[model samples]
Target: MKVKPLKDNILVKMIENEETSPNGIILTGAARGESNLAEVIETPEIFGEDQEILLRGETVMVTPHCGTEVKVDGETYRMVSYHDILAVFEK
Candidate 1:
């Protein structure tokens, strides 16, 4: 099952960070740092407006509560708009 986002929408797969801190303190789900970071999955061939700086396979930090979550082929993913993408991370 492949996904292709429309307009400025982007498909992202959440990247969960470790549950423990550097100091060895185990963090609970509520205590975990907010991880808006995710890997870009797919985007439209051409954007409706300005060309988006994001591309498939890139990791990005998105705005919290900016996207809709979905389950595809038993895998969880989020569909976020271009404006919701706050920052792109280098591999």
Candidate 2:
């Protein structure tokens, strides 16, 4: 929340797979895997961290659905390459 990513650097908040469906259908957490798509909220500070350059807006989707996972502020998230991004969705 306090940290801001730089150019070409996307801060993604990985979404967790649903344990229960909207129709009252329930599924065990182990039954479903983690989500690959992540929401890009902010871009890091340019000239810092030393990276290529990505935008601040939009989501950076990942591929193979098996990337890297990160935990921030007691929350679980993920970080994947921009090239691995599949698509962006509106939250």
Candidate 3:
């Protein structure tokens, strides 16, 4: 099926996480008790440093915890209301 995001909704392609560091640093998945940072690979033209995310990776970070999740080209993303969106970054 074909789907299109509504106003303020964006489609993003998720980048797979790296299993090892470029310097050959081996990193293994942590246990449940271990805290890991969420890895998000975004395009420079989409979102930049110091700018609030209005829409990204097809998902919108609305109110820090509220937003709709979406998918594009078999990749997961998100959607958000315009008010929930902060800004759209483009280079």
**Which candidate number has the best lDDT?**
1
Q: Write the per-residue lDDT of candidate 1 for residues 1-91, one digit (tens) a residue.
A: 8888888889999888779998999998878866889999888788866666577899899998779998999999999999898888887
Runs in model 3 deviating more than 4 A are: 30-67, 71-75, 80-91
- The residue-level lDDT of candidate 3 at 16 comes to 36
| lDDT of candidate 2 over 1-91, digit per residue (tens) | 4655434445577756787877868877666666665666555555445444555556555675654566677876555555566666554
Error of 3 at 72 (Å): 7.4
What TM-score does model 1 achieve against the real structure?
0.89
lDDT of 1 at 81: 90
Candidate 3 Cα deviation (angstroms), residue 12: 1.2
Better of 2 and 3 by lDDT: 2
lDDT of 3 by residue, 1-91 (tens): 4555554443333233466767877667742222211222232333335544433334322345434556556666544344554433343
RMSD score of candidate 1 (Å):
1.4
Q: Residue 3's C-alpha lDDT in candidate 3?
A: 51
Cα displacement (Å) at residue 50, model 3: 19
Worst 10 residues of 3 by lDDT: 31-40
How many residue pairs clash in model 2? 12
Local error of candidate 3 at residue 68 (angstroms): 3.6
lDDT (0-100) at residue 88 of candidate 2?
Answer: 62
